[model samples]
Target chain A: IPVLALGIGSPTWAVEAAHERGSLIVSLVGAPAHAESAIRAGADLLVAQGTDAGGHTGPIGTFSLVPQVVDVAAGRPVLAAGGVATGRHLAAALALGAEGVWMGTAFLASVDARPSGSVLDKLLAAGPGDTVVSRSDSGKTLRMLRSAWSDEWEAPEAPTPLSMPYQDILIGDLLGQILRHEVAPLVHEAAGQGVAHLTAQEPVAEIMGRLVREADQVLADLGTTRSASPASIRPAT
Target chain B: IPVLALGIGSPTWAVEAAHERGSLIVSLVGAPAHAESAIRAGADLLVAQGTDAGGHTGPIGTFSLVPQVVDVAAGRPVLAAGGVATGRHLAAALALGAEGVWMGTAFLASVDARPSGSVLDKLLAAGPGDTVVSRSDSGKTLRMLRSAWSDEWEAPEAPTPLSMPYQDILIGDLLGQILRHEVAPLVHEAAGQGVAHLTAQEPVAEIMGRLVREADQVLADLGTTRSASPASIRPAT
Candidate 1:
């Protein structure tokens, strides 16, 4: 079985446990403060997450966090994640020294993903700035589209969300009800800032392929050649 | 002197003023929503800005915003800005369809810039996540490094800042005091998220030349086979 590194809590014990079981460990947690601990605990790789990521995220952005983690890892491979949905983004991540890229928002927009039609529609209509990072949704700072539910939590009068498991348990039923009923206006959707970039729904394979192709094109453009073709290369008149 | 087509408030007004003055009008404000308005107002070019940018910015990131702006500009030159301080970033901006790139944060780090040494030092020390968008400094959401002042404003008891000139007037003295005494701890300094990537301060001309060279190399690698190498492109890869 593939080992999934959960980043929500301390992975030190988990890393030790995974090592004991001889399983590969992946950590999805945020916060650069944890990098030393994660490395000391024997995390093979690191996933640098941004606030624009769909799930739990540390406040630091990919632009700031990736290089720092790269410096800290001392030559270990780091995967860039959070709000990465396009080929251009993938190219940018590689340029930032990421060995590979992980994208949740891109997969969320895939047809096979569990999101409903309306949710997908809303995601497609959104832009990078349309999402907000708030803890009210899942007891951690998760990126979700700006909605009434998110706005309520942002309001001064709203109660602070409970800690994990308890908070998820408390609102799980309500969240399910909202998702099942197609009540987008009432439900708060956890998504990334990349949601706004999604103009349409495509299959996961197509999306991934497009991303790879685009990234290759970008990389090729940046490689040893100066211009793509004669038509693209204009001379000084 | 080059006549700057300064966008005052409305794109329509900006265009009319530029036409009347026989100057090249530039849109200074942000927001992708303004693209159509600028086009309707006869904009000759577009500047795609990202949220990571210093000063004023739109909600769209440079990656997502530039392509759309380029498409809408319909062959007009598009200049990219916001959080661009390195050769890699400039290359990425050009790859995304921008004809040229504009940089501000880099200039802020220059010796000619008027920022106090302490402010510059603080900026040099900050990481990308150190900066945040807060309306407390300016009525509009501007990006700045998180400092005691910004943290205080974020506190529950902080007062809502007055609009524009009023706030400027009210806080002008405080700002001056902070700067005069090098009380940087009391004020949030304006900068971009790219500051985290900068390791040293160098001459602007050298930095600019390096960026152009790097961009040329990147463009070459992108499958472009043009030979218009700038003086900065050193043969050794």
Candidate 2:
């Protein structure tokens, strides 16, 4: 096994069981207290998810969450996630004290991603502001495309969305119909704000190569302190 | 002036005028398109302000926003802001293609901060989840502490807060009274999610020294790729 890990927001009975079973537990934390608790619960790793992330995310941003989790983790590895799409994000994550990065948005633009039909077209063209976190489904925050359906659901006159299974069931048929008809404006997509960087639909290998090269360049730049000082800011003779 | 730059979100009438005076205008943008416009509007530098910042911020996270801004900035310098409270954050910003970083929350715990009474005590103890973005005044979103006032205003049953001047006037007296009484839970404090990192009150010089030392250490670590080979991930001969 190549280091199997479980991803969870809370440490439950299963987490300790997983630890005992020799599986590494990767606890996801949004708050600093959760980071502490995750470490206390015997997690081998921590993933800090920020508000700008896709699918489900919490109140803080990745820039704020990673450092806090790394501090609480002490020496344990902490992976930075949410809004990481390009190679520069990997470099940024490492600089933030993360051992690695976890990203879901970049692959959506890759040929291998399982997003159906013309979804990649939409994802590739969308800008950074196109995603929003709303309680339109399951009465819980989810980061997805800013569709008309989401906008209507978030409108002042709309009723509060029901919780969990009931809300999922309630919205299922509408989602199906929208996708079935390819109603672009009503479609919901689990894309992070980093979707803004997707320029063309390329292979996973191409993406990986670019990411590694960019990260390497960033490291080289850091070693040299790459900015040139303006003569005005230089010490006067 | 060494470099006369304007800090603003909108393209004010004075921006072009300042450019005419041979000053390097610096505009703050959250979206990539905004970066493009700021450049077209005679800005010589761009500051990417992510949503993790206090006072005013945008929807994207710093990790995602920085590279995007840098890409669109062309030859212009780009600075990253929001949730930058440590040397690690500065390193992260630089890795994301920023020339520098802008910070606010770190100074709140410094001796120079103007917080009265035991406000600094509470700030030092608060975690990453302590701040929230609420539409309390100006009808514009502002990042601040999760106080009773914000909670009450954000509650579902609460009436829509008035806009701008009216809103400020409406909440002014209440805020003044809360400050006068030092009602800890009701006082609105502008702090970013990075408040979790604040541990003690120190001098500005001390903070700067530690930040420089930590940044140097981070750069050195990057040059070396500081990570031990895991036994589990070792290649079998």
Candidate 3:
């Protein structure tokens, strides 16, 4: 419960500081170098994040990044993040040598998500192609459902988005206002391409239970029995 | 033996032609729409190609794309492509509801790859970050090991590369000359982000064997047994 999961983009100081305190630290990585660095920096677990992730994601895909990170981890636990939504994804992550999965987009439309109603509505109606990765929102590569405003920012002649805090600061107030007003076309909420498939929002427990149920069904369908401890995930199913 | 798996970015003619001959058409798709379209166009199987794949790829990641494609396919076999380098990756794909996997970058290091010495050397020494995806090579988004030529073309202010056939035609002669002359900085060989995990080059049989062997181990480790026909993959083991 005291564990901390930090995005790889976050400063290394946070990872190191968490490790020094004897609390388990999970570092999300995009490339193999980061995975190795996280392990060396004393991360308890590494999450290989693909570009499909909603928040600040890297150029590499989860399918590609996870195995690379796992190999470099040298047996350290590595979880696959980004594009993680269903139980089958958990099975895939484990097959790819991930200890688990880390996801954010699945919860974006949840009952508790603070995004405005219009933003949630747009997310539910969008397809995979509806999402785009751009720095216009946060100065870093963040994936979100495409809006008229987001599309303009990616136009060939559009101004290059400012980097980091500058861009975030510049757009922060405007973005907040857009969300507050429930302007869907002008709203940009962090989401992955998987946002295309997830249409409904339900209780967190239901989502978690469904993921476990689907994963168990997938495992059974594949004729693969559970090899790891079921105590952790069984109760949910 | 009657199955043909064509990379999807190519026009539909090849796929249509193959399907007409009563062969199983497995067209690679990078997006969910492509998956649905392929199935409608008579493709027997769909390979969801992610951006991490070598050669031409799309924006979505395999973890995100595969499940989406699977959902659309309903019951059609959906294979995962791009970033598929090892058995664990294969297992992950299957877990994600892929019937199988499609791979090519893993073989780039093989003796049969036929790239120039400089390209091979670069590939061997490269990491995930060492490569890039750009249309500079053939005017389409192809992932390859980054070289001086590719980097310059990708610069923010660089002129956009031409589209398809024309771009390919323009670069064809230049690429041939660069490779023939053993130019190091000008080299650009199609590779995936998983290129970092595969370093050595051997025979096709060795690579294939390792892939199957590793896959079986992963399956077994997961407390699962092979549910599908193992004859073909088992032989490699």
| Ranking, DockQ, top scorer first | 2, 3, 1
The digit string of per-residue lDDT tens for model 1 on A137-210 reads 66877778888878888897899898876788888888888889978686657777667668877888898889
lDDT, candidate 3, B1-237, per-residue tens: 477766744356766677667667767888877776776667776788888888888788888889888888887777788888899998888899887888888888888877568888888898888778889877878888888988899787788899887887987898898888988788778898878866787888999999989987887767543233322111000
Give one digit per residue, the lDDT tens place, for model 3 in A1-237: 467777744456776676566567777888887877776666777788888888788888888888888889887777788889899998888888877788788888888775567877887898888888888888988887888878899887899999988998998899888878877678778888778767787777888999988887876765543233322111000
Model 2: colliding residue pairs: none
Error of 1 at A24 (Å): 3.0
Q: Is the docking of candidate 2 incorrect, acceptable, medium or high quality?
A: medium
Q: What are the runs in model 1 whose C-alpha is more than 4 Å off? A: A29-36, A63-65, A163-166, A223-237, B1-10, B28-30, B198-201, B209-237
lDDT of 2 by residue, A55-173 (tens): 77787889888988888888787889998877778888988999888878888878877666668777877888899888786567888888888899989789888887688899888
lDDT of residue B70 for candidate 1: 68
How well does candidate 2 score on lDDT at residue B46?
82
How much native contact recovery, as a fraction, does model 1 achieve? 0.18
Task: Give one digit per residue, the lDDT tens place, for model 1 in B7-92.
Answer: 33445665666567666555543555666677677766667666667776545555456666666678866777776766667666
Q: Which structure is stronger by TM-score: 1 or 3?
A: 3
**What TM-score would chain B receive for each of the candidates shown?**
0.86, 0.87, 0.87
